[model samples]
Target chain A: MKESLVIQANNLSKKYRLGTIGMTSLREDLSRWWTRSKNGIPKHGFDQAGIDPTRMINDHEFWALHDLNFEITRGEVVGLIGANGSGKSTLLKILSRITEPSEGKVKVKGKVASLLEVGTGFHPELTGRENVFVNGAILGMTRREVDKKFDEIVDFAGVADFIDTPIKRYSSGMTVRLGFAVAAHLEPDILIVDEVLAVGDLRFQNRCINQMKSIAESGKTVLFVSHQMATVENLCKSAFLLNMGQIIYSGKTSDVIKKYREDMEESANLPISQRMIREGSGKCKLSGIEFRNDQNKVVDSLISGKSATIKLFFDIYEEITAPMSLSLGISNSTHVRIAHLCMKTFGKWILPTSQKSFQVNLSLSKLELNQGKYYVTSFLDDESGQIIDWVTDAFVINVLQSDFYGTGMVPPTSQSIFLMDHSFSF
Target chain B: MQKQSITVLKPSAGWTGFDFAGIWQYRDLLYLLVRRDFLAQYKQTILGPAWFVLQPLFLTVVFTLIFGKFAQIPTEGLPPLLFYNSGLIIWSYFSHCFTGNASVFTANAGIYQKVYYPRLINPLANCVSGLLGFSVQALFFVGYFCVYKIFIPTASHFEMTSAMLTIPLLIPLVASLGLGMGLWMSVLTAKYRDFNQITGFLAQALMYATPIIYPLSEVPEQYRFWASLNPMASVVESFRFALLGKGSFSFHLLCYSTIVAVLLLLSGIYFFKRTERRVVDYL
Candidate 1:
């Protein structure tokens, strides 16, 4: 017989009305009352009336999570991987009963404890000991259970000396440690954590990961979501990759990470003009950006140890051309910028006309970037004063590996610097 | 090829029901919150818990001077100080419950957004903590009653009746009213926010509408019907009548107030339950 599943989701989907506020107008209130009076159930439908023409608005409906289905058996530790808006948090919220789904259903068999954020359910006025009970209760643990594990929690948090002190006085690190300890010791059947480990230092994070490993080993289910692929790969046996509110892949953790890397590469290969730059305040803006090969054809992907050209196309919006400089940086999925190249020493390429675009191509005898997603940052500066344009990560490009790099099977060895060459003297 | 039969379980609506077992399991949390509320309010104060008694005493003196001496409001032949103190104590409990519970969502938004718990625990804890405050004030009333009985022996001859037993009975009733109304208002305020602005004004208006400073007998006979219809009016009157045996306590009015309280409490719980899971989204 197949093992029993602790959590089951069938066609679970959540849709939120884009901009509707509260159900408070007299008419809406009356209709809600009528529906509840007639059926003894709160109505769950949205008003489809056209937007008020007086209001400045455009698109109305946006599905935060489309059709999603998955399952987890007892003792299974699963990782959820996705882009920022890919519905991972939404799924966790639904599973944790924080929000209701717009369609479909989910069945969870045992107690669930979710650490959506650190220090949740902690009252600043309450003592650390008091908050432990409150936080544990909020996470679905009994008071007696928390009491039984109180010492362990205090020990793990390393706040034994300050447990009697009000949490308002605790440092941010202490607060996070105590919060994680209470959650880890809560002993719920299923644990759901969402990027909470990102708050603490590396040591605490490692401790949390170890605790999660122990929890998983004890025949409990775990659902972990994070942008750190290494952590996900180390902690989870299975994984689900989500993109654009849909599950793109669900299988082995390593395979899903590999697939996500490939997807990133594919997106990075898009032309610079088509890059989707987020709308917000940044250091600088790119007037024009494009990547081209020696043949002058726009290219997005480059093989490792191969010649390639990066064209920095821009127009000088400000006038202060004194040793104007530029730098290019590359980063990985975790957003750790790993490399930087500057144009201060290189010969300057002057614009042909005022307010005109210029291109500067850097010829690499060999592309040293590893097989991963890398973004470029182009900076412009003038000596004795101002930094004109410092557009960082303006565009992304993929650096593929050739057979000489050894079948692309070996992970990149560089922690910070991308090695340009490797040779053996025999 | 043999097709495998998969057993799929449908999500049960029963999971949404009140998990009493869960609440019982988290009792320590309830006690911790009650302690926090009790201590935090008076942590740095000079008198500490003595402030609880002073609040009712101060209110009673002001009400006696205004409503008793100046307005000359009748107290059904009961001593003005005792009469006003009893009403003020009970009314304070209800008002505190209302205000504290109504602000539960807004006040704890930081925590609620980050965690999940039976939201009912919040209002329940507030009600219990407010009860402690009211109990402390009630002690002052008892002391005042005892001194009045000893020194002012001729002032309406104090006597405890079987009705006195009803004080404990009415405590839960009054609490239910406040919690229910507060839960309803808190849910509404999460979205409207105008309600938060108006809550203080509404609470003051409600105080005048209820017979806290004076007896129901002081109102005009024609308006007695309207005055008695205010659920809190009957609740306060019933509490004073139970303790002092000198105020109106009609069974019919009590039945009406009880029905209203039960209705409010059930509807409040229903509205709170329906909205608690989603209030964070709006907040």
Candidate 2:
């Protein structure tokens, strides 16, 4: 059977009032009324109040989302992707009826349950069993319905033994498990989930993913909001990329992801000197970084499964009596941690030394990473677990596609990290 | 996939429609909230729900000392203890619902911003849950009334009337009025935030405006019109009149208050729905 349109949002918009002294105080409220009336600008739609954030004048409104239009048929799993503060949350809030759109509207079929953040209505003081009932009610489940799914929810959360314990006494992981379990069992016709699913232990996340997959497969219309591209690619067939409160692109997940990557690369390809936006004590700074090929030549990129060295150049401003360790984290375009290596794991430490300048070269004999642009984040940590300096996105390195086994079986971008080669002949 | 085709959500048109049905749909949530508020109220305190009883008992004693003995305030020839206790219970119920409803949005900002249910559920829950606290305090008043009647037979003229039936009826009236006003303040407080503090002071002022301490007979004829204009003034007067059999009770004023309560409730809900969408950005 062909799918029918279950959700259609037309020219939907949500405007947010912003300013430091905004939305609070009677004075701000009066002034907002004043400015809104004097200007006679439709606060909805594309208002001219969206000045550059840096050049912001206090007491001005901004359209968080504007002129967004999309349609989803029954059983369609759609991904809504955006950079931070791209109005993803606002859009979901509007769709979920938590907030109304300042302009336009969204038409949805049947009941819609949105998990903008899982466990929203959970009470810490309430027992897990009590919260399960209360939280289920918040998600629009009847008491009898919750009763039917009660044991399954507890078993799914793996908290049956502690179901009667107060959620405050339960570990945060346990609270999150119960929360996610209840949310997963919500049998709504339309499901809208935000980025909160990225939390919880990895095993729990995997279980949630399986639950979401089963729910999506059962012909429920779903709209998923996430920044994690891999999760979106795995779950959504169609995707929308929101930038600056606008739906700039809407198409297949692959093409939208490609556009998103280009956007990330554009933002990240700033001059190296200016890209050292990091946070830590001023005791050390990553002055420069260099990537070297196996032939001892400095290069911007290295071939996959080939030998390379990552040299981090730093300047120590002050002498320290405590031990220090150098750590490197490699992350993908979606900011997923691909791998982490620290010299302290190998019992190597930089003792209290008066060396003003230092360089640590990490040699990789066989870099099994697949083709993708990766970011290097370097950290200098003191013995007492204080960060001397930590530079996030300190440098960018691109790994080139290559046939590591000399066979044409190169891993695709979907599963593009650390795949070992093996073969069995019978 | 489902039978229903579409439901369009937009900025509501005209006077915001009250979703009484929506509140009914979320009745279970409302029940849980009432339970949570009634129970979670005195978690850390050693004297837990007993304080609900003690607070009114202590207040009744103090009011008896100051108003009955010191000020010699006339309770329309009724026993001062019975008179003041009657007004105090009703006053406290209104104040609880009124002030608590005012802070509803701010207190539940954590959950309100993250979830979607009928926004009315919050205030409705507070109004309903406040009864639990009132019930405990009312029990104390009953016992105190019994003791006063048994101890001082000459000072009391206790007689039961069909009007006493209004006592049960008063709960929903006071609750609806307070909830209506609270709903109004809920949105105002959410936007201004400073109103959260002001509502407490407002409640105190309103208590004076109502006949909690003094009887309506003392308002003086010239000022009675202004005093009776307050919607709750009639609710308090009628309640005392129904129970104690002696206080200024006008049939027309009761009708006036009933009309005002209905209007306040509808308008309060109207304003609440309008502000619900607007305040989220600020919150």
Candidate 3:
């Protein structure tokens, strides 16, 4: 353990059963208990030496987190960046005492508070005024402490006028403001925030970020988790980049972010339909997807300022009496939707009901995105906005380094999402 | 001046995580949980908290009809209203406390998942707030006692004495038993949720087995030992005796039940702390 460390950890791990709670009967649960006690968990992933994908995994168990170690010193701002289910939430849970680590220990020498999300304890039925008390209590604030900071919290949330209104009636943004305000005002020696910035509009996001910066500046040890690489790079001095429940990189935030992007790009070459995680109503299915150039050539990489085309192939099993629109969204690595194209807005005809497979092509006159890798999400919905199918992060596409203005200044991905046409007259 | 410091042990600390000081530190949370449960139960209803009293009061009437009027079950010569209402008072409290504590984990899963606190605070609050609800039923029972006192016009109807002072003793006896049994059931229910249905059924069936519907003397000699196995049987019996100076009394049985209650409570706390570290993930 380092001398200034507030948290020290050894080989921390956690295991989870395959079946969800209550889905298994008592007899099956007892059997799982037997298997667990007997150490019958199958050696999967990193636990096994060689990559054996077909080794008949019979243990019905998986490790959400494996042997990984890190230390956090007092007043250190550490960032955890990983894809979905990369064990980021599990790590935070173990740190916050919401779950136990199966294989190791963590010694924390401070009063810790984990802001799981905005409104972690807010009751919809409680008025904003009363919820102030209840949410404050849930966050480990004494009533007197809440009373002392009551005015500041209200003013920070900007809900003084509707303080007595039931939180259920408060707009979603209002509730988040109040929730974040209460959490920021608390005086915990250690704070852990997870994915809270992903919510709310950009203005509120900036306000929350400023509030967090002040918390960090006040000499509190903070562990923050977010998918926003830009935010993480701006805030954290040290960071841990995890993949498949193991710490692949740890050090300066910029280096960790690079490691994360490289890991994402490693799997970029697979035909997305084979690699992407698919989930939705499945009323219709994304049978195939491809990106194309103006020459009508299917490709995976695009150059900025080119006329790009997105082609989606779908299979409709059932008859559609009304028109069903398709939507395509492109998001950068930050998990924020950068651009959206809906079929309804683009195509004006009410297509008749039919049961068949079809291909819809969308052509963009100019792809203005900066040089970066982006993922595609597709959605199909009926005229009434009933989602027939949605495949989030269904495909990965690379936007290559091209001079959009015919000048040599090929803007980097970090410059901006947009590359504008410009002339230098000076 | 020396500065105070705090330390958080990792989850794998296991048994060393036992800290009564932690529970004491979160006393306000316990109070808030109790207040929330009590108030939230009665809100939005036209009758509100009155149902707390009207519930047992009405049940007492029905019991008086079935056991007292129809069956003519001897109440050891005490007026039936006084006898039945006395049992109802304690039974209502115990069952209420027991049912709430038994499901405390699943019911407050939302709060527990997000925040870290001494999990025992939930059940402890349920027990205390249950007492408050019982006090209301106790008021209604006193009303029943007054009505019987006027109608029967006999010392046999009811009389207060030093025996009544044992009430303070009787309450925790019944409450601790409920808390103990309920906490034990909560742990079991967390792993095997079928224990939840069993807990519900047994809580109801327990009233029947506790001599609430029949006097302890009438339980047929052969079944007496098994019937008295219910710790609450003595708790309710003694509560009646303390109030009306009637019904059976045995110091040894009280001692036995008290020992059983304390053992269950300690073990319940022990297992609950053991499960607290991992149960949230399962939920």
Best by DockQ: 2
* Pairs with backbone N, CA or C atoms under 3 Å apart (clashes), candidate 3: none
In what order do the candidates fall by DockQ, top score first? 2, 3, 1
The 10-residue segment of model 1 chain B with minimum total lDDT is B1-10
The candidates score, on chain A by TM-score, as follows 0.66, 0.65, 0.74
Clashing pairs in 2: none
Instruction: Estimate, for each residue in B1-283, the C-alpha lDDT of model 2 and write its tens digit.
Output: 2377567878776685677788899999899888877656776679988888878778888999999999998878887778888888888899888888897777878777888898888888888778988888777777877787788888768644567777787788888889888888987887777787889899999998888899888989999899999988988888777777777667788778878888888898888887776666667
Worst 10 residues of 1 chain A by lDDT: A47-56
Best by TM-score: 3
Worst 10 residues of 2 chain B by lDDT: B1-10
Backbone clash count, each prediction separately = 0, 0, 0
Judging by TM-score, tell me the better candidate of 1 and 2: 2
Best by lDDT: 2
RMSD of each: 9.5, 7.9, 6.2
Model 3, stretches more than 4 Å misplaced? Answer: A1-3, A21-23, A27-58, A270-289, A292-329, A333-336, A340-373, A377-394, A398-426, B1-8, B11-18, B150-156
Candidate with better lDDT, 1 vs 2: 2
Candidate 1 chain A TM is: 0.66
